[model samples]
Target: MSAADDRLAARVRALAAAVEAAEGRSDAAVSADARAVVERAGERVAFSGSYTVVALAGATGSGKSSLFNAVTGTELARVAVRRPTTAKPMAVSWGSELPHALLDWLDVTGRHLVPSGPHELSDLVLLDLPDHDSTEVSHRLTVDRLVELVDALIWVVDPQKYADAALHEGYLKRLAPYADVMMVVLNQADRLTPEELDRCLGDLRRLLDAEGLRATPIMAVSALRGTGIKELREALARTVANKQAMTRRLSADVTVAATALAADLGTANVPRVDERLQRQVVAGLGAAAGVPIAVDGVRRAWRKRGTVATGWPFVTWLARLRPDPLKRLRLDLTPGDHSPTEVNRTSLPKASAVQRARADQGLRELTDAATSGLPRGWASAVRNAAGDRRAVLLDRLDVAIAGTDLEVRRGTWWWGLFGVLQWLLIAAVVVGAVWLLANPLLLGLGLPQLPPVLWYGVPAGTWLLVGGVLAGLLLGVLGRALVEIGANAHARDARRSLEDAVRAVVTEEVFEPVEAELARYRLARQQVAEAART
Candidate 1:
């Protein structure tokens, strides 16, 4: 084998290792697509070096029967009189040493041992596959799996149907990527005139080129007449002699499988969250929970500057008194408090079924777009990851909104009553204090300013009235400030909780899967590069 061929074999081994890694982590939140590809690849690698498979693939009645007989030098495969008779695969080998391990892996137990012949093709273990246009679905699957794993394929096309659409569309188009390991044989040249044969060959060449098979070797031969059997034999012999052809074929298979496995890795470039969307979600949740109104009311009532005694002491006491509205209503709005004690659906906006459905649709669309460049299996993995966590995501969001709603406390009429009683008590105390002092000189100074009744009967009545009025005004301001403070705190708490919830869902359900897939892909790619080097 050439140095290049040695490198190619090594590369295949490396690719196998990467696939094994994926399989090992199959249960660890891996994408379904990635897992499938890795599993397929691992199976192939496990069976490598077990057997040498040379598959005969071609259009219907392409004289592959004749060619198969000539190569094996036996009537092991039925010929012309029995054209298209084999409806299934038949294998012939020249020796018993042809590796039972390989045969077991191919799942073909009906093995035949053909005696070694003088023909150069004797060393090969030949496979006469069923017609590509077979009526059976099993036949098609057999052909497909063989095409994926076979060391080399001999594509036989007779003059009559060299350009058959079924062969090109159903087979060649899909196998274009494997062109390097494929060979096109223009069989049954005996049926055409020299000029007609030349034109047919030319047409076949053009078709092959159009199918992205420019580098694949094309050969013309008459399998029945055995006109070009010697040349075909020599070509097969040369490939076996060097061992490079087989190595290159294996290398190409490894790369193809690797490409599929690597796609399990999520996208390298992640789409970021839009700032506008973030802001909108935050505002929407806050407004729907009535956070702003609560905060504003508290701020307006609670003032930092105020006097308890000089300005209607009774009223001032009422303003300074805090309602503790959220606490009284049994709202659990403390930091680190995740769920609400009670779900106030009336105050909070519930995500409707329609909204949940929309979210699901959006997730599917985003996942599809993110994995558009990946293999079908890898794309499937992303989809499963998104689907599995969808309900959980919605539920967490609902809980967050509900939790916020409970914190948006509205100071009701009872709070106003409490304010009034607090002020009245302060007024009573201020009146009693002046009455107890009973200072005649201080009372006389205010006597002239007081009403005649107040000057004669009650000494501290004027001062008491002024103190009660000032106290009421101060109490009203304090009530407003307390309400505002509570509202602001609740709003901030809800926002933080929501942010945490969102991040948790995204990481567990989305980012983790993406990371696992990427790891598989990176490993597969590494294997391909290493195998190529070997």
Candidate 2:
């Protein structure tokens, strides 16, 4: 085989693999034709090495059977005996043995071999197909089947019907991609004068070119007169001798499959999962997972802890009676904190109907974006797969919320300092109270009356008690202001972390599958391009 032929075979193999992968990931309708090509290519290549199958195809009265006999120089195919109603193809090969296996695959039952003689037509399996324009439905179907399987096609037409609508519009227009393996024969040329033949050939060439078969070879021959018979034989010999007929035919099939597959692939690139998209999805999931409630828990828990540490020292003990906001909501426990006996589910309330609706909309938007520019069939498949993704979302969100660390430790650094200062002020008040009581006890016991220490024209005991009271009140007010600031800070932090966790969940449960499908799509396109390459 030539280097070009080897390259084509390798490409066809790669194309087959790519088509198979696409079928598994794609909708059946989108991939049906391309997959059929892949199947046909595999079967055709196995028999391609032995003989090149060149089929004679034409309308009912095109003298196609006569041309087949003229090229092979034999009456191997009974043109006079075959009826227009015959659907079975007559295969005439010059091989030593009848090509039974190959014909079986082609579903051909009638076969013959030319007697050993000059072997110019050897290495060729020539088929005289049934009339494509036959009145019989089965005959037409048979032509269609063989058309797909043949390695090369020789379309015969008489000067009178060379421009027939059924042959040109119905077949040639669609077969344009297989131009390399196809040729048009203007048969019965003996009926036309030299000038008439030139005009007719020109018209035929124009029509074929208009149908995108500009490179398709055209010949004017008379099978009965043996006109241009030897040249046609030489062309057939070259097609057989180069051993590239099968490769060319399969390559054209690849082109046809790739072109069809490209329709479903659309002219768009894959969509991405950006930060903005993630944030949108996370917002919805956070609502469904009680993110607002979780943030509120963080704020309240921060203030609750702060109250005990910085409230009036005498009254702060009462603050301990309040429940911890995080503990009550079970947001304080990370997933790793769970023991073997603990359940994985959190104590957060179930999402309300409104929140659930919001989440579903978000997930739907994701799939919509993923399939934005894709064709209907592929988009439909991706959406169906997204249904399975949606099933696990609620469970995934629950785990995400449970796994987030909602504790606020950085908000409590000054709490100890405030508490110690409050206690020092309390000691001053206690000292003042003791001094006042000592005076009463000493006077009653007839001891010497203590001289009162004065400060700013007031009794020292009164100043000590009053000043401590004023300072402690001022400090308590300042502490409450600080607690509010810290609570807001902690609330924002918890929201960020929870949103981040929710983002991770959606990426795994939602976007991963979509990306996998996108990768498959890219692979299909790449493979098709390779298969369609020359």
Candidate 3:
């Protein structure tokens, strides 16, 4: 392919991708019409490029077939007085071998090859299309279909219906974008007086101007009287010579398709998943996954384990009597053992209706934040994407929370030192008590008198009993205070870890899908912009 052909093909492919991207998200009719344009243009571009396909289109009783015959200098199409005479299209090819593939693609069965003539119009394949305003729906349908495929259109109008609303409003205005490749011919001009013909041509020009077709050429032609036929043939010869009709027509098609889809590409500003939105998502998921309750459980469990480790040895049994809070929640007491099977369902309560509603609202807010500047259609698509798997969101979140390894083990060195000290103090107090109790037994057995120990002028036995008991109580109280503080810090850390895990789930389950949709929209916008550019 040449550079121009490669460019056009690339554009067509871009347009096709845009249409595919918009299939389910955009209006069905708009997407279908764009798809049709892409398909038809692709077929035309791939076929023979040597000939230009020009169609003579008009309403009923406009002498379109007569103009067709006059231009080709052969009676190719059957002209009749009956309304809507040409039910099917007839083609007249000039100068070269018949483009059978092109004609077949156009579905024009009636073909005529004209001998080479003086007009130098050898590269033209002129078609006489059915009346666009025919009472028969099929004829109008045929006209609509062929008009889209033709390389250039010569709209044949008669003075009687030159300014008719049906012709101007239905065909001319809709095709205004193709003005560069369109022409208006006032057929049967010989029937009017010269003065009347001039007035009618001027009025037709004004009407075309109103329809936004000011650049489209208009000429007066009479197929029967042969007036102004040369000018029409010359105009067509120029079109065939330039060989840009196909490109112009295809470009116009792209414009129309892109314009139809412009509403969907609301803004060039791409939507983003920002940190604030991600935080909102994490917060919501945290609530739904019951992170607060789990964190609280971890804190209580930490304190319980700390009491067992650092409390006075005799009273520490009381702490052991209570179940470990983390164990009750099915959380691992040890850190870093994160086997999937080791984790179990948490005893944390299910999310209440209020919490679930808050979570849902948070998700909606995140969606709104991400799609803030987008068009309504695109915003709706993004929101829908976020909620696509909403039914399973809670289950996934629960599993994520369960799988998170919250570091809740209480293995501090200070606690172990405090535990040994508590044990040594308890031993001192027990030994002193036993020594005092055995005094009576020693007297009853008539044993020798025990030596009295003294410390700072007081008996060492009394000092051991009072000092050990008091110090043990003080150490236990201080250790409990330290454990409480440490537990709170641990709880905070665990909460943060759980939130991070939930955020990961939110990103994977919600934000990722929404982001993917936004990416698609961005790609589609880029492709459309490229295809629509000149």
Q: Which candidate number would show the highest lDDT if scored against the true structure?
A: 3
Tens digits of per-residue lDDT, candidate 1, 304-339, equal 111222233434556457554333322334544435
RMSD of each: 9.1, 4.1, 2.7
Q: Which stretches of model 3 miss by more than 4 angstroms?
A: 1-7, 81-84, 115-119, 267-274, 333-343, 371-374
Candidate 1 has a TM-score of 0.59
The lDDT, on a scale of 0 to 1, for candidate 3 is 0.84
- Tens-place lDDT per residue, model 3, 1-534, is 556667777888888988877767777788888899899887998885778999999988889988888888887778776744788989998864678999999999988887766447887899999888878898898898899899999999998888888888888899999999999998988899999998998888888898899989999888988988888888888998888889889988988897777666765588687887688778877887789888999889888888889887778898899987777776763444446566456667888998888888888888877788876667788988899888888777777777787776546889989999998998889887776666677889998757777789887777778888999999999999999998999999899889888888878889889988888888888888878776
Ranking by TM-score: 3, 2, 1
TM-score between candidate 2 and the true structure: 0.82
Q: Against the true structure, what is each candidate's TM-score?
A: 0.59, 0.82, 0.92
The runs of at least 3 residues in candidate 2 whose Cα sits more than 4 Å from the true structure, single-residue gaps closed, are: 10-30, 81-86, 98-100, 115-118, 186-207, 220-228, 268-274, 334-342, 349-371, 381-388, 409-414, 417-475, 517-523
Q: How far off is residue 517 in model 1, in Å?
A: 11
Clashing pairs in 2: none
